[model samples]
Target: MSRTSHITRTTGETGVDVQVGLDGSERTVEVATGVGFFDHMLHQLGKHGGFDLRINVKGDLHIDSHHTMEDTAIALGQAFAEALGDRRGVVRFADASVPLDEVLARSVVDLSGRPYMVHDEPVELAPMIGTDYPTSMTRHILESFAYHARICLHVSVLRAANPGQKPDAHHVVEAQFKSLARALKYATRIEGEDIPSTKGVL
Candidate 1:
């Protein structure tokens, strides 16, 4: 089956459109919100999620990344929710553990139509490959994704003993995205036409 979705949103704050293909070849992301770091993070999300994602954001980024980032998450979440249709025989639950060298990260997701996030702090992680802004933006992105998509998400990083180890923010953030990708990949898979739950809805 062809699994794809297109979504559009416009408000006084922003104008956004996104197209995503779940069962497509690799990924191609085009995001220019003028937030350089946020763009990189979204690109990583698309690449590792194995989804062909194209996002266009026309927003007042001169203000900040808030509008761009939150709207992007909302659009993408709407796309996924639309593409999934009725939840239908999908796994609905998925988890992944990813390690970027010493920085290990884990993400767990449930397509349960309940929005929630549980994160473990420090909340401080060295960037995996980009600037600090996107690193901080990750938390907000995850929160928006879960809320708009009506999913439950939990993320945590185990405190490793190597306090002196050079913490690479880029690597840590990349690991987080990779973990999310794997978790989402499994969660969105289509198995049959059942509701994935005892109740006939998600």
Candidate 2:
């Protein structure tokens, strides 16, 4: 089965193009979004998910990173959903726990053709990772992706070993991305020829 999709989204505020190959083995990824930290996080997704992904985005960054980040998530989610293509023979459900230094994140995923997301991060982070990327946008990114992809997703920062200090923004976000990537990799695995749903569709 060829699970691949290319998507283009354009608006007054942003222009985004994405390509995804769910069954790809090369783990090839190329991303240019103008936001340095965001690009790094996206690379983690493709690398750990074992997917071939390419994303190019141009947005009105003169205003802020909001439009670019949100639009990218939407475009990526749409491409992922299109690549799934009836969800036949997919594992359909998975979970993963990932730790990065002082932070531990857990992600649970179900590709059930229903959109829902619950994201919880207890530790506080700095307002911005750098000059442009807002720390708050991390959860929003996952929520937007899950909504557009029609997937059930639950993510949480389950532990922080900071000893009464706030967690590092980079570690917190990286752990979430890694956990989500692992979960997605497992959920997209081909286990059999039949759909992994009871109602015969996903």
> Which number leads on TM-score?
2
lDDT of each: 0.78, 0.93
Per-residue lDDT over 49-147 for candidate 1, one digit per residue giving the tens place of the 0 to 100 score = 788888888987667667887888899888888877767778899999988777788999999987898875344455333432646667888888888
C-alpha root-mean-square deviation, candidate 1: 2.5
lDDT of 2 by residue, 1-202 (tens): 6899999999999999999999775668999999999999999999999999999999999999999999999999999999999999999999999999889999999999999999998646778988899989998999999998999999999886578787788888889999999999999999999988779999
**Measured by TM-score, how close is model 2 to the native structure?**
0.97
CA error at residue 37 for candidate 1, angstroms = 1.9
Kindly report which residue stretches of model 1 are placed more than 4 angstroms away from their true locations once superposed: 25-27, 124-134, 159-161
Residue 133 displacement in candidate 2 (angstroms): 1.0
Error of 1 at 16 (Å): 1.1
What number of clashing residue pairs does each candidate have, in the order they appear? Answer: 9, 0
